[model samples]
Target: MAIRRQDILAAAQRILSEYGLADLTMRRLAAELDVQPGALYWHVPNKQALLAELADDLLARVPEPSSRRRWDRQLTQLATDLRTTLLGQRDGAEVVSASRASSLDTSHLGKRIVEIVQAGGHTHAHASASRDALLHFVIGYTFDEQSHALMAEHGAAPARFGDSDAAYAAALSVVIAGVRAPTAGRAAPRPAG
Candidate 1:
Protein backbone atom coordinates (compact mmCIF):
# COMPACT_ATOMS: atom_id res chain seq x y z
CA MET A 1 0.00 0.00 0.00
CA ALA A 2 1.23 3.51 -0.82
CA ILE A 3 1.79 5.82 2.18
CA ARG A 4 -0.08 9.10 2.30
CA ARG A 5 0.73 12.42 3.99
CA GLN A 6 -2.06 11.95 6.52
CA ASP A 7 -0.74 8.49 7.30
CA ILE A 8 2.70 9.90 7.98
CA LEU A 9 1.25 12.65 10.17
CA ALA A 10 -0.88 10.22 12.13
CA ALA A 11 2.11 8.00 12.76
CA ALA A 12 4.18 10.99 13.75
CA GLN A 13 1.54 12.11 16.26
CA ARG A 14 1.41 8.61 17.71
CA ILE A 15 5.17 8.57 18.13
CA LEU A 16 5.08 11.96 19.72
CA SER A 17 2.43 10.91 22.21
CA GLU A 18 3.95 7.51 22.97
CA TYR A 19 7.67 8.38 23.07
CA GLY A 20 7.89 12.16 22.83
CA LEU A 21 9.39 14.42 20.17
CA ALA A 22 12.94 13.06 20.52
CA ASP A 23 11.70 9.68 19.33
CA LEU A 24 9.54 11.02 16.50
CA THR A 25 12.31 10.96 13.90
CA MET A 26 11.75 10.15 10.26
CA ARG A 27 13.58 6.86 10.60
CA ARG A 28 11.42 5.89 13.55
CA LEU A 29 8.32 7.03 11.71
CA ALA A 30 9.26 4.88 8.71
CA ALA A 31 9.76 1.94 11.03
CA GLU A 32 6.38 2.56 12.57
CA LEU A 33 4.84 2.67 9.12
CA ASP A 34 6.81 -0.38 7.98
CA VAL A 35 8.21 1.49 5.00
CA GLN A 36 11.63 2.59 3.81
CA PRO A 37 12.79 5.90 5.28
CA GLY A 38 12.89 7.41 1.81
CA ALA A 39 9.19 6.73 1.43
CA LEU A 40 8.40 9.44 3.98
CA TYR A 41 10.19 12.02 1.84
CA TRP A 42 7.64 11.44 -0.89
CA HIS A 43 5.04 12.90 1.47
CA VAL A 44 7.18 15.33 3.47
CA PRO A 45 10.39 16.94 2.29
CA ASN A 46 12.00 16.85 5.73
CA LYS A 47 11.45 16.39 9.45
CA GLN A 48 10.88 20.10 10.04
CA ALA A 49 8.18 20.20 7.38
CA LEU A 50 6.57 17.15 8.89
CA LEU A 51 6.74 18.66 12.35
CA ALA A 52 5.15 21.89 11.13
CA GLU A 53 2.31 19.98 9.60
CA LEU A 54 1.85 17.97 12.78
CA ALA A 55 1.86 21.07 14.93
CA ASP A 56 -0.81 22.67 12.78
CA ASP A 57 -2.88 19.52 12.94
CA LEU A 58 -2.63 19.44 16.71
CA LEU A 59 -3.63 23.08 17.08
CA ALA A 60 -6.64 22.57 14.86
CA ARG A 61 -8.47 21.34 17.94
CA VAL A 62 -8.45 24.83 19.49
CA PRO A 63 -11.63 26.84 19.07
CA GLU A 64 -11.55 29.75 16.66
CA PRO A 65 -11.89 33.27 18.08
CA SER A 66 -15.49 34.26 18.35
CA SER A 67 -16.57 37.77 17.39
CA ARG A 68 -19.85 37.49 19.25
CA ARG A 69 -18.20 37.39 22.65
CA ARG A 70 -16.35 40.24 24.33
CA TRP A 71 -12.75 40.39 23.12
CA ASP A 72 -11.19 39.87 26.54
CA ARG A 73 -13.45 36.90 27.32
CA GLN A 74 -12.73 35.40 23.92
CA LEU A 75 -8.99 35.82 24.40
CA THR A 76 -9.21 34.12 27.77
CA GLN A 77 -11.07 31.21 26.20
CA LEU A 78 -8.64 30.96 23.32
CA ALA A 79 -5.56 30.98 25.53
CA THR A 80 -7.02 28.43 27.93
CA ASP A 81 -8.03 26.18 25.05
CA LEU A 82 -4.54 26.41 23.57
CA ARG A 83 -2.93 25.45 26.87
CA THR A 84 -5.28 22.51 27.31
CA THR A 85 -4.62 21.30 23.78
CA LEU A 86 -0.85 21.52 24.20
CA LEU A 87 -0.96 19.60 27.48
CA GLY A 88 -2.94 16.83 25.79
CA GLN A 89 0.07 15.65 23.81
CA ARG A 90 3.58 14.69 24.86
CA ASP A 91 6.23 17.35 24.11
CA GLY A 92 3.46 19.24 22.31
CA ALA A 93 4.60 22.69 23.40
CA GLU A 94 8.10 21.98 22.13
CA VAL A 95 6.77 20.90 18.76
CA VAL A 96 4.58 23.98 18.39
CA SER A 97 7.40 26.29 19.52
CA ALA A 98 9.77 24.77 16.98
CA SER A 99 7.18 25.10 14.27
CA ARG A 100 6.60 28.78 15.13
CA ALA A 101 10.32 29.58 15.31
CA SER A 102 10.93 27.95 11.94
CA SER A 103 8.13 30.04 10.41
CA LEU A 104 6.39 26.82 9.49
CA ASP A 105 3.28 27.21 11.67
CA THR A 106 0.30 27.54 9.33
CA SER A 107 -2.44 27.36 11.96
CA HIS A 108 -3.29 31.05 11.64
CA LEU A 109 -4.17 31.07 15.34
CA GLY A 110 -2.10 34.19 15.80
CA LYS A 111 -4.09 35.94 13.11
CA ARG A 112 -7.26 35.15 15.03
CA ILE A 113 -5.82 36.71 18.14
CA VAL A 114 -4.86 39.85 16.26
CA GLU A 115 -8.29 40.10 14.78
CA ILE A 116 -9.86 39.79 18.21
CA VAL A 117 -7.56 42.49 19.59
CA GLN A 118 -8.32 44.81 16.68
CA ALA A 119 -12.00 44.27 17.26
CA GLY A 120 -11.43 45.60 20.77
CA GLY A 121 -10.41 48.96 19.23
CA HIS A 122 -6.66 48.51 19.19
CA THR A 123 -4.59 49.50 16.17
CA HIS A 124 -3.09 46.90 13.88
CA ALA A 125 0.37 47.34 15.42
CA HIS A 126 -0.95 47.04 18.95
CA ALA A 127 -3.06 44.03 18.05
CA SER A 128 -0.08 42.30 16.45
CA ALA A 129 2.10 43.01 19.46
CA SER A 130 -0.59 41.69 21.78
CA ARG A 131 -0.88 38.55 19.69
CA ASP A 132 2.86 37.93 19.95
CA ALA A 133 2.90 38.55 23.69
CA LEU A 134 -0.13 36.36 24.35
CA LEU A 135 1.18 33.46 22.28
CA HIS A 136 4.65 33.64 23.82
CA PHE A 137 3.18 33.50 27.30
CA VAL A 138 0.78 30.66 26.51
CA ILE A 139 3.32 28.54 24.63
CA GLY A 140 6.19 29.14 27.03
CA TYR A 141 3.98 28.58 30.03
CA THR A 142 2.61 25.33 28.63
CA PHE A 143 6.13 24.18 27.72
CA ASP A 144 7.25 24.54 31.31
CA GLU A 145 4.22 22.66 32.58
CA GLN A 146 4.79 19.76 30.18
CA SER A 147 8.48 19.61 31.05
CA HIS A 148 7.75 19.45 34.76
CA ALA A 149 5.19 16.71 34.22
CA LEU A 150 7.74 14.67 32.25
CA MET A 151 10.36 15.08 34.95
CA ALA A 152 7.93 13.98 37.62
CA GLU A 153 6.88 11.00 35.52
CA HIS A 154 10.50 9.84 35.24
CA GLY A 155 11.00 9.98 39.04
CA ALA A 156 13.11 13.09 38.90
CA ALA A 157 13.41 15.69 41.65
CA PRO A 158 10.23 17.15 43.02
CA ALA A 159 8.90 20.25 41.26
CA ARG A 160 10.28 23.57 42.38
CA PHE A 161 7.29 25.38 40.94
CA GLY A 162 4.17 25.14 43.04
CA ASP A 163 0.54 25.20 41.87
CA SER A 164 1.13 25.72 38.16
CA ASP A 165 -2.53 25.99 37.30
CA ALA A 166 -3.15 28.92 39.64
CA ALA A 167 0.08 30.56 38.60
CA TYR A 168 -0.79 30.28 34.94
CA ALA A 169 -4.24 31.71 35.47
CA ALA A 170 -2.80 34.65 37.40
CA ALA A 171 -0.12 35.32 34.80
CA LEU A 172 -2.68 35.08 32.02
CA SER A 173 -4.79 37.58 33.89
CA VAL A 174 -1.86 39.99 34.04
CA VAL A 175 -1.34 39.67 30.31
CA ILE A 176 -4.99 40.20 29.53
CA ALA A 177 -5.08 43.15 31.88
CA GLY A 178 -2.22 44.75 29.97
CA VAL A 179 -4.00 44.14 26.68
CA ARG A 180 -7.13 45.75 28.06
CA ALA A 181 -5.25 48.76 29.41
CA PRO A 182 -6.10 52.06 27.74
CA THR A 183 -3.33 53.08 25.38
CA ALA A 184 -4.80 56.52 24.77
CA GLY A 185 -3.94 58.09 28.12
CA ARG A 186 -0.28 57.05 28.23
CA ALA A 187 2.11 59.98 27.90
CA ALA A 188 4.43 59.94 24.90
CA PRO A 189 7.98 58.95 25.72
CA ARG A 190 10.43 61.86 25.97
CA PRO A 191 13.79 61.74 24.11
CA ALA A 192 16.83 61.08 26.31
CA GLY A 193 18.53 64.36 27.26
Candidate 2:
Protein backbone atom coordinates (compact mmCIF):
# COMPACT_ATOMS: atom_id res chain seq x y z
CA MET A 1 0.00 0.00 0.00
CA ALA A 2 1.10 3.53 -0.80
CA ILE A 3 1.32 6.19 1.90
CA ARG A 4 -0.37 9.38 0.76
CA ARG A 5 1.25 12.84 0.66
CA GLN A 6 -1.49 14.25 2.85
CA ASP A 7 -1.04 11.36 5.26
CA ILE A 8 2.62 12.27 5.51
CA LEU A 9 1.70 15.89 6.21
CA ALA A 10 -0.96 14.89 8.74
CA ALA A 11 1.49 12.58 10.49
CA ALA A 12 4.05 15.34 10.63
CA GLN A 13 1.46 17.71 12.09
CA ARG A 14 0.64 15.19 14.80
CA ILE A 15 4.34 14.73 15.53
CA LEU A 16 4.90 18.48 15.62
CA SER A 17 2.00 18.91 18.04
CA GLU A 18 3.31 16.07 20.19
CA TYR A 19 7.04 16.92 20.25
CA GLY A 20 7.43 20.36 18.65
CA LEU A 21 9.45 21.28 15.55
CA ALA A 22 12.92 20.26 16.69
CA ASP A 23 11.94 16.68 17.38
CA LEU A 24 10.44 16.11 13.92
CA THR A 25 12.43 13.42 12.14
CA MET A 26 11.69 11.31 9.14
CA ARG A 27 12.66 8.20 10.99
CA ARG A 28 10.37 9.10 13.85
CA LEU A 29 7.57 9.85 11.40
CA ALA A 30 8.18 6.54 9.67
CA ALA A 31 7.98 4.75 12.97
CA GLU A 32 4.81 6.63 13.78
CA LEU A 33 3.38 5.53 10.47
CA ASP A 34 4.61 1.97 11.16
CA VAL A 35 6.60 1.94 7.97
CA GLN A 36 10.24 2.11 7.00
CA PRO A 37 11.75 5.54 6.46
CA GLY A 38 12.16 4.77 2.77
CA ALA A 39 8.41 4.69 2.51
CA LEU A 40 8.41 8.31 3.58
CA TYR A 41 11.01 8.98 0.92
CA TRP A 42 8.64 7.51 -1.59
CA HIS A 43 6.09 10.21 -0.76
CA VAL A 44 8.51 13.01 0.14
CA PRO A 45 11.96 13.23 -1.34
CA ASN A 46 13.68 14.68 1.73
CA LYS A 47 13.17 16.66 4.89
CA GLN A 48 13.42 19.99 3.09
CA ALA A 49 10.70 18.90 0.69
CA LEU A 50 8.56 17.84 3.61
CA LEU A 51 9.06 21.17 5.33
CA ALA A 52 8.17 23.08 2.19
CA GLU A 53 4.98 21.13 1.74
CA LEU A 54 4.13 21.53 5.39
CA ALA A 55 4.65 25.24 5.25
CA ASP A 56 2.64 25.44 2.06
CA ASP A 57 -0.18 23.60 3.71
CA LEU A 58 -0.08 26.05 6.58
CA LEU A 59 -0.08 29.16 4.39
CA ALA A 60 -2.50 27.98 1.72
CA ARG A 61 -5.86 28.60 3.30
CA VAL A 62 -5.44 32.20 4.51
CA PRO A 63 -8.37 34.57 3.86
CA GLU A 64 -8.33 37.04 1.02
CA PRO A 65 -7.95 40.71 1.91
CA SER A 66 -11.11 42.82 1.90
CA SER A 67 -11.32 45.85 -0.39
CA ARG A 68 -13.74 47.96 1.65
CA ARG A 69 -11.24 48.77 4.41
CA ARG A 70 -8.26 51.08 4.67
CA TRP A 71 -5.03 49.87 3.09
CA ASP A 72 -3.37 49.50 6.43
CA ARG A 73 -6.38 47.67 7.74
CA GLN A 74 -6.21 45.38 4.73
CA LEU A 75 -2.63 44.58 5.59
CA THR A 76 -3.50 44.09 9.24
CA GLN A 77 -6.15 41.60 8.28
CA LEU A 78 -3.59 39.91 6.08
CA ALA A 79 -1.16 39.77 8.99
CA THR A 80 -3.85 38.35 11.22
CA ASP A 81 -4.70 35.79 8.58
CA LEU A 82 -1.09 34.72 8.50
CA ARG A 83 -0.83 34.71 12.27
CA THR A 84 -3.98 32.74 13.01
CA THR A 85 -3.17 30.10 10.41
CA LEU A 86 0.34 29.66 11.77
CA LEU A 87 -1.01 29.42 15.31
CA GLY A 88 -3.60 26.80 14.42
CA GLN A 89 -0.95 24.11 14.73
CA ARG A 90 2.10 24.16 16.96
CA ASP A 91 5.45 25.38 15.58
CA GLY A 92 3.82 26.35 12.28
CA ALA A 93 6.12 29.32 11.80
CA GLU A 94 9.13 27.15 12.56
CA VAL A 95 8.23 25.13 9.52
CA VAL A 96 7.24 28.16 7.39
CA SER A 97 10.34 30.24 8.08
CA ALA A 98 12.56 27.39 7.06
CA SER A 99 11.11 27.33 3.58
CA ARG A 100 10.69 30.46 1.48
CA ALA A 101 9.18 30.50 -2.04
CA SER A 102 9.47 26.76 -2.24
CA SER A 103 5.74 26.31 -2.34
CA LEU A 104 3.26 27.92 -4.71
CA ASP A 105 0.93 28.79 -1.85
CA THR A 106 3.48 30.94 -0.07
CA SER A 107 4.67 32.34 -3.35
CA HIS A 108 1.16 33.49 -4.32
CA LEU A 109 0.50 35.08 -0.93
CA GLY A 110 3.82 36.92 -1.04
CA LYS A 111 3.07 38.30 -4.48
CA ARG A 112 -0.41 39.41 -3.46
CA ILE A 113 0.73 41.24 -0.32
CA VAL A 114 3.60 42.94 -2.11
CA GLU A 115 1.26 44.09 -4.85
CA ILE A 116 -1.12 45.66 -2.33
CA VAL A 117 1.71 47.37 -0.49
CA GLN A 118 3.04 48.81 -3.73
CA ALA A 119 -0.42 49.94 -4.72
CA GLY A 120 -0.56 51.81 -1.43
CA GLY A 121 2.30 53.99 -2.84
CA HIS A 122 5.33 52.43 -1.19
CA THR A 123 8.32 52.23 -3.48
CA HIS A 124 9.12 48.78 -4.75
CA ALA A 125 12.06 48.52 -2.37
CA HIS A 126 10.01 49.72 0.59
CA ALA A 127 7.23 47.36 -0.34
CA SER A 128 9.66 44.44 -0.45
CA ALA A 129 11.10 45.30 2.93
CA SER A 130 7.66 45.93 4.40
CA ARG A 131 6.49 42.57 3.16
CA ASP A 132 9.37 40.93 4.99
CA ALA A 133 8.66 43.01 8.05
CA LEU A 134 5.03 41.96 8.04
CA LEU A 135 6.00 38.32 7.63
CA HIS A 136 8.43 38.58 10.53
CA PHE A 137 5.79 40.25 12.66
CA VAL A 138 3.25 37.56 11.98
CA ILE A 139 5.74 34.73 12.47
CA GLY A 140 7.24 36.16 15.65
CA TYR A 141 3.86 36.92 17.20
CA THR A 142 2.52 33.47 16.38
CA PHE A 143 5.72 31.84 17.69
CA ASP A 144 5.29 33.64 20.99
CA GLU A 145 1.64 32.68 21.15
CA GLN A 146 2.42 28.97 20.67
CA SER A 147 5.50 28.92 22.87
CA HIS A 148 4.73 27.13 26.11
CA ALA A 149 7.87 25.06 25.67
CA LEU A 150 9.95 28.17 26.11
CA MET A 151 8.06 29.05 29.25
CA ALA A 152 8.63 25.58 30.68
CA GLU A 153 12.31 25.73 29.84
CA HIS A 154 12.62 29.10 31.53
CA GLY A 155 10.71 27.86 34.61
CA ALA A 156 7.78 30.26 34.35
CA ALA A 157 5.24 31.96 32.15
CA PRO A 158 6.76 35.23 31.03
CA ALA A 159 5.30 38.27 32.75
CA ARG A 160 2.90 40.20 30.57
CA PHE A 161 0.74 43.32 31.01
CA GLY A 162 -2.55 44.55 29.61
CA ASP A 163 -5.10 42.64 27.59
CA SER A 164 -2.76 40.80 25.22
CA ASP A 165 -5.15 40.56 22.28
CA ALA A 166 -6.21 44.18 22.58
CA ALA A 167 -2.63 45.29 23.08
CA TYR A 168 -1.56 43.49 19.94
CA ALA A 169 -4.48 44.81 17.91
CA ALA A 170 -3.90 48.33 19.17
CA ALA A 171 -0.21 48.20 18.41
CA LEU A 172 -0.94 46.93 14.97
CA SER A 173 -3.43 49.71 14.49
CA VAL A 174 -0.78 52.31 15.27
CA VAL A 175 1.78 50.66 13.05
CA ILE A 176 -0.69 50.45 10.20
CA ALA A 177 -1.59 54.10 10.65
CA GLY A 178 2.04 54.96 10.00
CA VAL A 179 2.23 53.01 6.74
CA ARG A 180 0.34 55.52 4.68
CA ALA A 181 0.48 56.76 1.11
CA PRO A 182 2.47 59.93 0.42
CA THR A 183 -0.70 61.82 -0.44
CA ALA A 184 -2.02 61.03 3.04
CA GLY A 185 -0.25 64.05 4.46
CA ARG A 186 -0.81 66.49 1.61
CA ALA A 187 -3.19 69.32 2.44
CA ALA A 188 -5.17 70.77 -0.46
CA PRO A 189 -3.23 73.50 -2.27
CA ARG A 190 -4.41 76.99 -1.33
CA PRO A 191 -5.59 79.45 -4.04
CA ALA A 192 -2.63 81.27 -5.65
CA GLY A 193 -1.34 83.69 -3.02
The residue pairs found clashing in candidate 1 are none
Tens-digit lDDT string for candidate 1 (149-185): 8888788847565776788889999899888884646
Cα distance off (Å), candidate 2, residue 68? 3.4
In the range 1-193, model 2's lDDT, one tens digit per residue, is: 7888888899998999888888998889999899999888877888888888888788887888898876677898987778778877778877887776344324777777778888887887767666666676667776776675467567788555557667667766655665554346789778996
Instruction: Give the best candidate by lDDT.
Output: 1
Per-residue lDDT for 119 in model 2? Answer: 80
TM-score of 2: 0.80
- Count clashing pairs, candidate 2: 0
Off by over 4 Å in 1: 104-107, 160-163, 182-193
Per-model lDDT: 0.86, 0.76
